[model samples]
Target chain A: MLIVGGGVVGASIAYGLAEEGAKIGILDAEDSDFSASRGNFGMISISNKGFNNLAYFRLSYASSRLWPEFASTLREQTGIDPAFDLKGKVYISVGDREFAAHAEKVAEYARRVGAEYQHDILNRADLRQMLGNVRLGERVTGGSFSPLDGIAEPLKLYSGLLNAIQRHGGSILRDHRVGRIQHQRGIFTVEGPWGSLSAPRLVIAAGLGTPDLASQVGISVKVRPQRGQMMVTERVEQSFPYPVSGLLRQNPEGTIMIGVSTEEVGYDDRTTVSVLRSLAMKAIERLPDLGSVQITRCWAALRPRTEDGYPVYQESHERPGAFVITCHSGITLAALHKRLLPQWILGGRKDALLEPFGLGRLQSASAA
Target chain B: MRPPHDLPEPPHQVSFRFGDEEIEAWEGETVATALLASGVMITGVRAMSGRSRGPYCLIGVCHECLVEIDGLANQRACITTVRQNMKVCRQTRLRPLTGEDETREQ
Candidate 1:
């Protein structure tokens, strides 16, 4: 088996497939590639997902639930801890109106999800009590906590998966971005400026690079780049009870990770001062104590967002064994991809959860 | 270890209080320099690991010299100019916040 794009998504699938005794080779891009897997907030969030699409929500929730075992398994295999923390996460609001809107949105999500949805609308006092050491801004009204939401150290998780892949006897080819792909007689040949490799089966899990390669194998992956800017503050003592959603969280190392903005700036991943300043302003407004904290660094990354903001999982009808899988929430869905995707790729029974994410839906919607 | 450079004495000196001890500093020298000159090398303990820390970069870049000055926390000693009778304390990590800071004594 040959997998293209050695980001978390590809590395995860390769690790999973290798565990099933398949000889695997993963083609990763250069170190400087704008890989979202390396730049995401590492949020294992289930709240506020699938508001318009129920299937996506279920997929995320299932993956979030599968994280504990996935983290432990990776640790056991590679002896590297991914630092998966599932305590809970919250989304803070700085005003009465914002709090009302946030509360209503959480309520709406609960209504849409029916049972299995758990969250709490914490008032300002409750939020203060929860964040014991930290002081909230005066205008900070309240926030919502979702028990299933959490975080993991993204770099550690990625490294652990890569280590596990190697431990399972999978070969990793770094700096081998495939420039061309040819399929003939049930064999797929991938060629690049660096070298060439062929396998009977192929999976393209590249983030923004999926479309070009997917098209060659008879799959038209419709993905665009969505830029998100983030900031990191100086290392400080962990004060929050748990991660406060994706907007704010202190990593295990003590540095506070703050982010992010959604912008349609094509493939540019440059941090803007305006965006950084606004993020800092918002952060200070929500947690006034952070106003004095020095910002250590800031960066931007591109999310491989599909047209409908949902993941695309499909095999090429033209090329029988070729597959394309891409998603924005690579960290959140990595567990599912590792636990479930390999089986389907190896001709095992397809999970019904994957039904709604196929390319057919996109084609039908466009056709209609 | 690199040998220390010799320097001429400053024209004037100032005094400041660093945790119950009054230390002498040259008029133009920063707090970190004064602390080092007075043989007070270990300025504070790291918040996370409780490791003893002192002035790393005397240019106010490393943030290793952060000490509490006059009840204000996270003041960089490398950049702070010493004044007479200024009260400075080791900037301990959040004690009231976590309440489990085992490194407070360090």
Candidate 2:
């Protein structure tokens, strides 16, 4: 199997395929390439995902459930802890209006996902109790906590995945961005400046670089870059009971990781002062003590999102052996991609759960 | 080469407290250099790993010279100038997660 792109998505799938005794060669881009896998918040976040699509919700939930075993397996294999912790996560609401909206969203999720959807809508007092260690700002009305949500160290997870892949006999070709992709005579060949690598089967898991390569294999992937800016504060002894969604969470090392603004600014991944200021202001509004903490570092990364902001997992119809897998939630779905994707790729049963994620939906929706 | 008489005079000495002991340093020297000059190596221990860490880059980039200045935590000792009677404490261990008594689980 030849996998293009060595980001988490490709790495996770390649790790899975290699563990199954399949010969895998992953073509990773140069260090300068824009990679969301390296710049994500590493939230195994289940809540507020797949609100429109139940399949996505179920898939996310299942993957979050599988994180414990996945993290442990990687730790056992490589002696590197991904720092996966499932202390749960929360989405804080500042004003009464936001709180009401959050409550409504939680209620809808409960209705749609049924009994297994574990979420607790907390009032202002309840939220204060949950975050007993940290001081909440004045406008902190309430929030929702879902035990299904968690966090992992993204860089460590990426390192662990790549290490596990090598440990399981998978070969990774770094600094080989695919310039030309070709399918001919029942084989796929990926050409680059370094050289060319060919295989009987190919998986295009390249992140923002997927669309062009996927098109060569007759797969239409409309992936675009959505910029997310983040910052980490100076190391502090403060800790949180749960990672607040899109706000902040104190790492085990004592630095508080705060993030994430969604912007549709083409492919530019540079951090801006405006976004950083707004993010800092928002964070301080939620946790007033953060006002005193110095921001250590700030960065921006582009997430490759489909038009409707959902994952696209589909094999090429023109080229039967070619598959294109792309998603923004690579961290959350790494477990599923590792555990379940290889089965279908190896000509086994295609799980019904993945059916909705195919390009067929986009095709039919466009037709309509 | 310039003559020794042309060389500028060294700055006068200033003293600071590093924990219980008093350390003297050149007036313009940083807290990290002052501590190192006073033979107080292993300035602090990493909170997570408990590994001994001191000023590595001495340019305030590595953050290994983090120490408490006055009442503030995580001060960059390499950048802070040594002041008279300034109290510097090696960050031995992380403070409790919440407050004085309670600690949060990882």
Best by TM-score: 2
Q: What are the runs in model 1 whose C-alpha is more than 4 Å off?
A: A364-368, B1-106
Weakest lDDT window of 10 consecutive positions for candidate 1 chain A: A359-368
Scored by CA lDDT, what does every candidate get? 0.85, 0.86
Among these predicted structures, which one has the highest DockQ?
2
Pick out the ten consecutive residues of candidate 2 chain B with the lowest summed lDDT: B97-106
What TM-score goes with each of the models? 0.84, 0.93
Candidate 2: regions farther than 4 A off: A364-368, B1-6, B95-106
Model 2 lDDT per residue over A1-368, tens place: 89999999999999889999999999998998888986789899888788888999988988988889999999999998999998898878999999999899899989999998899999888888888768888999999888888899999999999999999989998888889988789988889999998898999998999888987888776889999999987787756767898778888888888889999999899999999999999988988777667788899999999978888888877888888899989999999899989988887556887888888878532121
- For model 1, name the residue pairs that clash: A90-A245
- lDDT (Cα) of model 2: 0.86
- List each candidate's DockQ score: 0.14, 0.32
Tens-digit lDDT string for candidate 1 (B59-86): 8788888888876656789999888889
Residue A252 local lDDT, model 1: 68
Q: For model 1, report DockQ.
A: 0.14
Model 1: per-residue Cα lDDT over A217-256, one tens digit each: 8887688999999998766667676777657888765778
